[model samples]
Structure formats: C-alpha cells, structure tokens
Target: MEQLFTLAGIAIGSSGLSAIVVAILNHHWAKKKNSSGKLDALVEAQKVLMIDRVRYLGSSYIHDGEIALEDKENLAEMYQAYKALGGNGHLSTVMAEVERLPVAEKR
Candidate 1:
C-alpha cells in the first residue's frame, strides 16, 4: 500500500510538471508570433505616416508652390521611406501630377 501511494504521487507530480512545460512552450511560441506581427504593424504605421506627409506636401505644392526647402527634403525622404516599406505607386503619381500643375506665387 505504501509503495502504491508513492507511485501515484510521482505520477501526479510528473503530470503537473508536463503541463507546466507545455504552458511555457506555448507562451514562448505565442510571443514569437506576436513579435513578427508587431514589426509588420509598425512598418504599416510608418507607411501611413509617410503617405500622408507626401499627400500634404504635394497638395501644398500644387496649391501655392509654397513648399519650403525643409519640406521638399522631407517629401523626398518620405517618398523613399514609403517605397522602402512596400508602398504602391500612388505617391509618385500624385507627385507627377503636382509637378505638372502650374506654379503659383505664395500668398
């Protein structure tokens, strides 16, 4: 009877340990998956910011030809960043259209 109780206790302890090991592994895998997704989300956010900046700059240029030197540099940087992050060609198209628009004097 004493040996049977000891065997049963060992079995229960091992079962609990197995469950803990499985939990830890599951948590690690989940964290790994989330890390990849989080990076993608961050890149997507950067793309959105750059795209908006490009649009705003393009519109300002089209309306008034009022882009400052700093803004022009920023537009170029944003375009490069957008392209690096898998942006479509919409920004290039918009910029081309803006270029074709007649320049206006700044108010």
Candidate 2:
C-alpha cells in the first residue's frame, strides 16, 4: 500500500506538470493563429479597397483624366490603414495600377 501511494503521487505530479506545459503551448498556438487571422483579414480588406478605388477611377481616370482630390485622399488613407495593419511594402498589383492615376492638382 505504501509503494502504491508513492507511485500514484508521482503519476499525479507528472500529469500536473504536463498539463501546465500543454496549457502554455495551447496559449502560444492560439495567439499565433489569432495574429495570422488578423493579418489575413487586413490583406483582404486592402485588396478590396484597391479594387474599389480602381473601379471608381475607371479607364479614363487612368489615361488622360485625373482622379478627384477626394479619391486621392481616400486612397492615401486606405494605404495608411493597410500599412498600420502590417502590410508588406511591396505594393499589390491593383495598388500599383491605381498609383499611376494622376491626382487632380489643387488650384
């Protein structure tokens, strides 16, 4: 009975230690997954915003015509937001295309 109790105590101690380790690992993984999810969301939002900006400008806006001052402001604001969200410096294709659109000079 004494040996059995000793064995049981050892078993319980090991399990408790293992449980703490498992909990720590779980927390780390959860934090990593959450950060990944947030980054993915930010990228998606930036893509959508870029697409919308292009659509708003149209081909004419791309060629000879200039984008409205408001459009330019919105694009800058969105790009800032994207950067804040940890976007890479490499511009998205849509973003590059939109950047070529001339902003109307303030008179």
Candidate 3:
C-alpha cells in the first residue's frame, strides 16, 4: 500500500510539472507569433507607402513633360527600392514613361 501511494504521488507530480512546462512553451510561442505578425504588418505598410510615393512622383514628372536630372536620379532610387519591396508591374509601366521624359537643364 505504501509503494502504491508513492507511485501515485510521483505520477501526479510528473503530470503537474509537464503541464507547467507545456504552458510556458505555449506562452513563448504565442508571443513569438505575435511579434512575427507585427513585423509582417510593418513590412506591408512600408511597401504600400513606397508604392504611393513612387506613383505620385512618377505621375508628377510625367505630367510636367520633363524632369530634372537630379530629380530623375532620386526617382530611380525610389523605384529601385519599391521593386525591392515587391512592387508590381504597374509601376514598371509608369517608370518607363518617366524615363522617356526629357531631362530639364539646371539653371
């Protein structure tokens, strides 16, 4: 009877320890997942902002019918970054149009 009680006690302790370990691991994973989701959201926001900037600048330059060399260089850098962030082909068309615009001579 004493041996049976000892075995039961050991089983209960082991199960309790297991439950605590599982709880800790679950908390850690949940925190990690939340952080990963936040990072993804931030990256998506950045991509959207970059796309908007590229579209605005490209459209403005196209409408003006000319772009300054310095401005064109800046636009090119922006476009490159946009592409790096997985921008689609729509901007590619706009960028091509911008490239065709005449460069304005500096005063």
- Give all TM-scores, in the order shown: 0.62, 0.51, 0.83
lDDT by residue (11-66, candidate 2, tens digit) is 99999999999999999999999999999987788766755654454544566567
In order, the Cα lDDT scores of the candidates are 0.81, 0.72, 0.90
Weakest 10 consecutive residues of candidate 3 by summed lDDT: 81-90
Best by TM-score: 3
How many residue pairs clash in all the candidates, one count each?
A: 0, 0, 0
Q: Listing every candidate in turn, what is its Cα RMSD in Å to the true structure after a full C-alpha superposition?
A: 4.6, 5.1, 1.9
- Residue 34 error for model 1, in Å? 1.1
lDDT per residue as tens, model 3, 58-91: 8998999999999999989988887787766758
The per-residue C-alpha lDDT of model 3 at residue 33 equals: 100
**What digit string (tens of lDDT, one per residue) describes model 1 on residues 5-32?**
9999999999999999999999999999
Clash count in backbone of candidate 1: 0
When 1 and 2 are scored with TM-score, the better candidate is 1
Error of 2 at 11 (Å): 0.5
Clashing pairs in 1: none
Model 3, runs deviating above 4 Å = 1-7
